[model samples]
Target: MINKDSVESAYCFLHQKYRVYEFSNSETQRDDIEFAIASYVNDMNKELYAHLAKGRKEFLCNHTTFAADMQEAINELELRL
Candidate 1:
């Protein structure tokens, strides 16, 4: 079972990786970070749905509800494009 602390730790790691990538100059670095970010989001979705399947209705990570967390991340990505 993935603990809440582990999930939160990953969230913070991805958050910092993204912030660095957002300002990075190398195209190759940006591409790598993009891939990493996509993978992290996919994993998060799996975790969220697993909780939902077990009848846990609400999930909080990185100081936000799951939906809010996703929205914030999506908004940040969109702003860059």
Candidate 2:
């Protein structure tokens, strides 16, 4: 089974690293930070899918909906920016 705790921990670590940039009150800086976070999350998803077992991969594809939900959230956030 997939370890939710480990996944959450990894996500927290990544967020702490890339999502903690200081806001500089500049549109360009905000865009840069958003892009960086998006890139990091995309890379992380790629790595996760690569390492998952076949059954888990299938579970992600057919059972869980986090991928679509996350993409929708990202698109919404981008639109707001």
Candidate 3:
């Protein structure tokens, strides 16, 4: 039952944690930001999938979709930058 609001909130939290605004002025900086966010999301997906595979019932049933949504957000941010 993960909602859009929750996804957005998580993205905002990660956005702040990663200091994404620091890379707002140039192509290179934007690329760096995109790479950083992608890497972070990749790590998160790995850990989440691992837990899901281990039969962790608490893991979201739609985690792959959640990861995709996060990735789409990152791509949109990169485009805006």
TM-score of each: 0.46, 0.33, 0.34
Write one digit per residue (lDDT tens) for candidate 3, span 1-81.
Answer: 434554454456555634543435666765555555545544454533343235543232233443344444545444433
lDDT of 2 by residue, 1-81 (tens): 324554564355434433443335665764555555455445454444344322344322231443343344334333333
What is candidate 1's local distance difference test score?
Answer: 0.53
Per-residue alpha-carbon lDDT of candidate 1 for residues 28-65, written as tens digits (9 for 90 to 100): 88667666655664566465335433444332233234
lDDT score for residue 69 of model 3: 43
Q: Name every residue pair that clashes in candidate 2.
A: none
Better of 1 and 2 by TM-score: 1
- The model with the greatest lDDT is 1
lDDT of candidates 1 onward, in order: 0.53, 0.42, 0.46
Q: What stretches of model 2 exceed 4 Å from their correct place?
A: 1-14, 17-22, 46-81
Q: Model 1 shows how many backbone clashes? A: 0
Deviation of model 2 at 42, angstroms: 1.7
Better of 1 and 3 by lDDT: 1
